[model samples]
Target: MASTTPTQIDQAPPVTSSGRSTGRAGDKIFAGLSKGSGILLLVIMASIAGFLTYRASIALSKNEGNFLTTFDWNASANPPVFGIAVLLFGTVVSSIIAMAIAVPIAVGIALFISHYAPRKLAAPIAYVVDLLAAVPSIIYGIWGALFLVPQLNGLNLWLDEYLGWTYVFDKTQVGVARSLFTVGILLAIMILPIVTSVSREVFLQVPRMNEEAALALGATRWEVIRMSVLPFGRSGVISASMLGLGRALGETMAVATVLSPSFLINGHILDPGGGTFAQNIAAKFDEANEFGRDALIASGLVLFLLTLLVNGAARLIIARRKDFSGANA
Candidate 1:
């Protein structure tokens, strides 16, 4: 037999001249579509931000008053003057109240569903939560207007009679349900399902190994959750809060239905105080003049800024936690 040469052993498979690696045609198409879709989405977001900013600057340039500090939102005529202070305050206050009411209850319900409820019960409960999310904002607004408003008169009466010493409860009972407290309650109800669903999913994702280890070490169920589940899902909880807050801040119809429109800056939740940006825009945009439209756009710019600030703060908190954990590791 002829001896095999080293050259023959060293020989490699032939390659096509094209630099592309071999892959299925379908896979290549899918990859291209995915990348193109991402680029398209990014471009769309950037364009929207740019357009809003440009319009807002034009509006601000035409106004004579300080846009940040003024309490009123009258934007009717030429050289129109309006500010976002009252609107901004209302938006922030209502959202804060919503979160305060929603977060704890959401977490508790999520925890119960994931850890305590039977499998059959859990599925139905989760379905109910998702259904709540699917309910239209307009429906919520209508319900708030018709049902919630009527119910709140009794609440208002109770607060006025029992808690009258407090400034928040000191407002005269107008027999109308339109108040900041009512809006806050409605917002809380709307946002609760979102936070609950997120918290449930996150809690369910906890590692069984970590939980088991905690259990094996003579830890109670509550202790195991405290040691392993809550800490592991802290970031998820924060993300859920931010998501719920986004909804609360931007919700127009529901708030418009529940809150009595006002231009004054007041310190009490029970008082008819001020309107949010979404409510203000929705209530008056059609009636607004050219400069009024521009002013509304400027107010939108303030809301855009607020969203950016909130997201930035959340990121900072997440980043600092990551750094601290890395250092400890």
Candidate 2:
């Protein structure tokens, strides 16, 4: 074989100016596509915000009540009064309840699947969870309205009896559990699969070496998770929780179906009547006239803002703890 020399080395195949292994055309195409996709998403979001704002302004300009404080919505009335006070209360409270109930249980399920369950058990459970995530919102609404409502009366009664001192759990209404409390339980169920699936994937991504290091240090299985897995997956868990919360905040069909809609704020969550932004929009959109529709859009704008705030908060949390999120590992 010919011996290589300085001249031979210099005569080797010339690379493109960019010197990327994939060549300039491939790199440029991929970059353009990614940038374009991101731009398109932003454009769509902005369009929605603009449209909601435009319609909402029209509705607000003609409003007869304080947009923030008036308790009732009567878009069809002569003065056409409406406000989001009660709706905001219901939306925030119900979503908070959903997150409170779903997060711990979902995280536990994720941990069990990632760390404790055998592959045979985990695979089926994971598959079922994925299926649950795919189930339609309308179906969940129907299920909540029919099956879950009837079943939750006992739970409502129990909470009222024991937790009534807390005030929020006091069931003052004499009816089935078509209350914000019931809506929250239904929302918790709706968001559970989404949170669990994301958390499970995050826990599964824990570096094996890190886990082994914990074990080598005489850590128990739980201790290994506490020190190695939990820290690494904490950001991911927060992201998943925020994702679930976004859903809970905007859930329309299920809340409209299960929650007895009222225009007033009853502090007791277990009471029969309350309203949310999404539920109010969904329930009224069909029967609403042009102005009524705009009123609904105004409420939708509020829900949109709430969802954006939740996602922004999640991003901040993840950004703050990125070093411990296993990506560095």
Candidate 3:
């Protein structure tokens, strides 16, 4: 072997300084890019808000009806009359129903996939759920319109007959089940895959040591989940449910297909005469004049604000429980 000499050692390039300078340049570039991306997102959001506000103000100024209390959307009338009372009610009620139905089931399925099911079964089920999540909203709308509406008729009749005293279940007409209640059920199905997929991933992130310790303490499977899995994944579940709720709020085609859109607020959800903000906007956008278009824009503004409020609340909840979430782990 050739012996190394002082000259050879001294001839090595001064790479450390070069490397440090390159690293610093890269860091600055990355930081600047990240900051720019965030600012761009904020700018986009602000632009949307500004546009919606300007158009909505124009419509509201000329609105002959009270924007909050009036239930009729007669934008083309001699004195234009329109309000979001019925739309707000339908949107909120349908989303409430979807959340009520989807969240628990999604959580349960998540737990089952994470802890209960055998790996072979769990893999296939999870794959199927991901596929469901990818399905187009138009497909769901078509399915709801063609199949679900007719299929729900018998259930609607039963609910009306047995639960009539509840008022909400009482249907004024016995025709097709094209009511907000049916739309709620459809939205529930549409959002199911999303909530379940998020929740399953969250559950899977639970630390192995936590589950082992619980089992070592003589906890049953259910107890292990209740104590270790659930508390850790609570924030994630809330986030997933909030995402699903956002979809329910802005859903256009599916609700339009399933709900019989009218401008009346029927406290009876089983009745076929209510509408959602998105549904009404879709139903009325084409023929609406400039003022009518502005009216629709006003309704869109309400929905945009509603979605932002829901997401903000979810973020707050998630922040409060950050330690329990698996992110840090």
Top TM-score model: 3
What is candidate 1's local distance difference test score? 0.83
Ranking 1 against 2 by lDDT, winner: 2
Q: Best candidate, lDDT-wise?
A: 2
Q: Residue by residue across 251-280, what tens digits does model 2's lDDT show?
A: 998899888898889988888889999899
TM values, all candidates: 0.85, 0.87, 0.89
RMSD of each: 6.6, 5.2, 3.9
Model 3 lowest lDDT segment of ten: 320-329
The positional error of residue 121 in candidate 1, measured at the CA in angstroms, is: 1.0
lDDT of 1 by residue, 176-258 (tens): 86777788888999999999998899799787887897899999989998988898778878878888898899899998877
Against the reference, the lDDT scores of all candidates come to: 0.83, 0.90, 0.89
> Once model 2 is optimally superposed onto the true structure by TM-score, how far is the C-alpha of residue 1 displaced, in angstroms?
26
Q: Could you give me the TM-score of model 3 versus the true structure?
A: 0.89
lDDT (10s digit) by residue, model 3, range 1-329: 25677677789867566345777788999999999999999999999999999999999999999999998998877689999999999999999988999899889888989999999999999888788878888889889989999999899989989998899888887678888888989899888999999899889989888888889999999999988999888888998999999888999998887777888888888888688999999999999999999999999999999999998887887788766654444
The C-alpha local distance difference test score for the whole of candidate 2 amounts to 0.90
Which candidate model has the greater TM-score, 1 or 2?
2
Clashing pairs in 2: none
| Candidate 2 deviant stretches above 4 angstroms | 1-38, 326-329
